[model samples]
Target: MDERIRHLGFGHPWLRGGPGAGDGGETSRLPWLSSLLLAVLVLVGTGFAAEGQPDREPLDVFARLLLLAGPALLLLRYRRPVVCVLGVALSVLVYLGAGYPYGPVLITVAVAVFAAIVSGHRRAAWWAIGLLWAGHLLVVHLLYRHLPPSGDAAASWWPEVGVAAWVAAVLVGSELVGMRRERWAHDRRERAAAETRRADEERLRIARELHDVLAHSLSVIHVQAGVGLALLDSDPEQARTALTTVKAASKEALGEVRQVLDTLRTSGAAPRAPAPGLDRLPELAEQAAGAGLAVELAYDGERVPLAPGADLAAFRIVQEALTNVVRHSGSRTARVRVGYGTDRLTLRIDDTGPATGDEAGGSGNGLAGMRERAAALGGAIEAGPRPDGGFRVRASLPLTPKETP
Candidate 1:
């Protein structure tokens, strides 16, 4: 049965019987049970009222049956509230015209009105209420027109007052429930949007990390491979050394790539190798030298410890800067200077002007990635053609730890 319902596109969890079946079943059953119970009460109350008024005409079989069916019709209220309201109202009018004693059929009408309001049919609810009131007034006028004026006018008016109060309560209660449901739905939508934004930010962070890790290593490999090919026959020893450099750089790049993949496979739970930092700048410069660029590292002031993120960002900045020197500057020599200050660390990389006029103006992802790394740490970077006819990349990053407390 559950499979069939699902196949028919009625497969809401609330409809499928399983772990939460009890709750769903109870919810589905409660309204029907309550409507049935109200119908029984209406039947018993009307019987007592008819018994109390000995002078009232006994209802014919058809009228009595219709009065009893009024509340039963309320079972449809949840699915077809408007129809139920109209059906019950019409039944009440027929029963009353048959000279039967009034019963508690109005309870079902109240339930129908509440159902319609909560179902987002406020306009229809109002129409139903108006029609019911008009019918009630018509019945009252027709039934009491030929009767003599009674002394206790308040007693006769009490039923009308009670009916108005019941209707008002139903409408107000339904509106409150509708408002609560709307608020719940809005909260769910907000939570979903927040999760999507978080996922997007995480993806962008990984992409940036991969770009930084692979770009510099690949650039070195490209240079070394070219050198190996050029000297393969003439200077086999030098060519083998170049090939060795290529192998080592490729191996290190693969390890870093594997670490990144492991982090992703484990959903970032795996232990990661230590990230490269300023301390690795010497090795990075050596790799640049092997790639045919003579690189020098210079430091000013005493060495200061940096926050881990800041250290990594500084290293990447230098790595990318050296890469640009090798690929774009066409410079044979480059200088990297690190300065430790009172509250921050600054790095500068400058390359001798291009070897020839043709290689002066090509820029790519290296500079942009370097800039992003610096800016992410509340730092700034400047990269452009230098006044002395070379290219310079300068970055200043704060030494402040991310978690001070």
Candidate 2:
């Protein structure tokens, strides 16, 4: 085959946009310019090669049409690969058997075979190529005397070795290309699936954050509003203080909510305020106190800096546990113990006595959110009724940081 013709056919657009080429195995359009260029090259190349093979039959009208048939058939390769390959192979075989000059006419078969394989018609492509090879064998060894170019004698068997090698090379190279394309498609699907999972996890995290922020603040506001309403007639001064607590709680809640929203608004900008951590424990306790649940804090060891993810998780776990106590427990006090070890941070929150209502467990997402937070940080959260009396929530968090997804 002419090198230029081979190059042109190999670079054709049909090869890249064939079936299963990332367009979901659908043929969207035709490669008109490439097909025309290939057809022209095949015709011109064969005409030139015929001059070098004066002993063979000269280029005639029917012979030129056979050279053009392969490229014309390839227009349907993506949609009808089997038919296209069969048609192209048949035309090439007929041209070969007719004693016409051999040149880039083989390029047509190459293009058709490649397109068929790329479109996932490997068996059809193999059959087509195999048919061409067998037909060449018959024409060269058994039927040459009865064919055109009357005085031609039988060709040597050694060239058959090169032909076999060429066939093997074509099949091997086409199979390699097809395998690579399949791998590329698999990688694309994996990346897409991973991105979807990350999106879902991010959404769940945002929902959990919103729930914690609103649950704790709203619970406090609900209690303070009740206090303000009840003490309005009895003690105006206490009622004013209760209203003040409500105002402060609502304001803080708004700030936190805005911070969360800011993260969404800004793609990668820094947060307006730092995430809450153990340093804000006193503030958390004060808010719980405002809601009529007095909190006691006990520190067991020295505090150290923590990774941002672990710090945030620790803070949220405590906040959610305290909120649970405020909503469910009959006891008015909660004891929060913080132990700072070399590699771990332990937190224990307990409330004395039984629960307030019949449904003491408090059917809410607070506990589940805490568990998720701890688990995300490679930590664990345990919550249940104490054997003695009250409810207890214990969490163990690692000091090591985790990569942000």
Candidate 3:
């Protein structure tokens, strides 16, 4: 109901309101009848004058008033359609009642009847419509006190009912067509909005993933580059090994970025090799210890073999968590838990970071990337600063495979 009112411009006729209301389309179709009918009437008046038919003697003044007023009512048909119609009916009846046989007013009278039919008020239109046409027949005959020409029932009655009924049918049909047009327009807008939302979500996910990949790899390279620079004056061979680690991590970051881009370009996601999972936690623990951070790896629940994507997601979650700890935590202590339950794979990372600022939980996209990876695999995540003055990253991926196990 609200939509309908909006479409009709608050139902104010003074607003020049209708469907397609805001634009000039409603007024685009010119009212050709006003000009055309008057021009034809001018020529008609000239022709009748040439014929030199004698004008009628003066009748009651009321009859002349009606003759003047009847067709003028037609001009206001749409704005006050019923009033215009009723006025025409009464005025024309009075004109005939006072004995004018025929007049030029029938042009506007015919138009009024037809306008009423074309609008949706068939009942009002039909009644006034009946009086106008029926009055024409009765007036012509009774004034002469004789039957109309070719006065058979079929010939006389058929044109009136058939023409009016056809006009009413057209009005109803047009309203139905307008309804379909409105429905189509609404559906088109909704579909376009949905597409726009999907595009936005995809861009955000891409941004988060890009940040995680670059941040993780760059942090590792920064460590190795520092070691190489330190060992350059001490042990040349160890420095060369540090450079190799930096090179390998850099190459890995480039490959990850390219794979994400490839998936976007063709919408054909390439298979990613299985990455670090719970089984590789020992290596992560050793790396943290080497970096002078005490990291404990623990597990509960059933040990489950994760899919390749889930494994990589779990690895990144832990990686980002520990990286954040090293960068922010004053204490060199962190704990990671990989819990493989019956229906889900969970990775929980906790660090004794200062958790001082709003960014204590890693305000960057590392946490966001973890969540996105889990969500893409039909999963969930919750990460923020712990009340115990630390940060935690917990992610869960559903065990169900994308296709089949």
Candidate 4:
């Protein structure tokens, strides 16, 4: 099979307002043109031969041999797009040697330029368009003296010049249209990739939410169960009380788990209690007190209205901070402060204890969860040792979405 046959195109099918991606059907025009040009060559050669004109008139047998190669060159117009433009233009030069009319051959050159830009090199395509028509003008002005000039004043042959000018203009205009189509294709791909990334990130956020719900509840239950098992021998009554606390905590954990999983795993709407806000700080303090941590709750400023998202985010930030204090900070007493203002809400959890060892290594996902919650609120958090003793975690969140109406 010939390699040139593979690249022949039937022009663009989406010339009208059609889908850009289309199955390009055969146009049925190529064979017709090939036959017409062939008939022109045979009839003209026979008539002139009957008139006894020189068989080697201007383009002699040698030049006709190259002209014989022109149709084979036409098959190459779409293949080596840039190279074929020069080939057709060179064929035009060879045709000029035969005194053949140059009008019809210019279209093949235009098609070559159009093919180049559509193949994705805009600059090369543009240059090909210019140089192709320029070849026509150079041939007319320098080589073919038989053609008429422009009004006896202009050096350019106005007939051939007009034909070449339109060829260049149409090639360039077609390429501009092709560029817009290519850019649209590029933008569509980028948008699809962005949407996929957003979906993946959303799935990850839900995963983090599930982890937070399960880990906090399970950690509390694990501590209570261990205490109950330790007291099973001597303090059987206390052991029973610990088992009751574990059972209640486990039931509450199940409810929290259901709410979270329902929001994620199904289309059912989440519960509306507006989530936990700054108003629930005392309740959290009381729960910490039950767990044998000395909790001191404090507040400052007015009860400013908060965006529900900000409110819930603030509450979770403080909850995770305090949970870390219980598990890692080894602090006897923890102080939690909630300050509400017109513009923003600030939360701080400071724990005071004997500073012994640092919390590091294999601790997995405790402190990182606090930072993640804080970031989700469009806020900032810091956890590190304070000056005197113990550790502190502070997070600040805005009352409303800043970039929203």
The candidate that wins on lDDT is 2
Give the deviation of candidate 1 from the true structure as CA RMSD.
8.4
lDDT of 1 by residue, 110-186 (tens): 76666656555565567667667776666566544543232211125568887788778878887887667557767
Identify the runs in model 3 with alpha carbons over 4 angstroms from their true place. 1-168, 234-237, 269-297, 305-313, 330-333, 352-363, 368-390
Best-first order by TM-score:
2, 1, 4, 3
Give the residue spans of candidate 2 off by over 4 A.
Answer: 1-26, 51-62, 78-83, 97-100, 118-123, 143-153, 175-194, 233-236, 357-363, 401-405
The predictions' CA RMSDs to the true structure, in order, are 8.4, 6.6, 9.6, 8.6
What does candidate 3 score on TM?
Answer: 0.56
TM-scores, all models, native as reference: 0.68, 0.83, 0.56, 0.68
Task: List per-prediction Cα lDDT, in the order shown.
Answer: 0.73, 0.85, 0.62, 0.60
Question: Going through the candidates in order, what is the number of backbone clashes in each?
Answer: 0, 0, 0, 0
Using TM-score as the measure, the top candidate is 2
**How well is each residue in 1-405 modelled by candidate 2, as lDDT tens digits?**
556633634323433434453245356666677789999999888888888999999988999888888888878776666678888999999999999998998887888888778766777689889989999999989999999889889989999999988888888888998888878888999999999999899888888889899999988888889899999999999999999999999999999999999998886799989999888999999999999999999998888878887888888888998988888888899999999988899999999957877453334788899999999888899999999999999999997644556
Put down candidate 3 lDDT per residue, 1-405, tens digits, no spaces.
857844733334422322332223323444456735643563455345434423432334554455556556655556555556667777766654444434465555555555544443344445665666676566544543433222322235555576567546544564465456557777988999999999998897677667767776666676677789999989999898888877877887898788778768977565464434557677666655544468888888867666766776677777777777765666578888887778887788888777434333334666567777778888888978898878887888876443454
CA displacement after TM-score superposition, residue 19 of candidate 4 (Å):
21
Please give, for residues 1-405, the per-residue lDDT of candidate 4 as tens digits: 334322332233312212332114322223347634753564456345434523223434654454444445545434344444445556655554454433344455455455555655444445555554565556555644544322222245657667656865876677787877688878988999998998886676566665655565555566567778999998999888777766765776677667666666665576633466667777667555545567788888877667766776676666666666656656768998888777777888898866536542224665676677667767788878889888888887776732446
Q: In lDDT terms, how accurate is model 1?
A: 0.73
> RMSD in Å for candidate 2, one decimal?
6.6
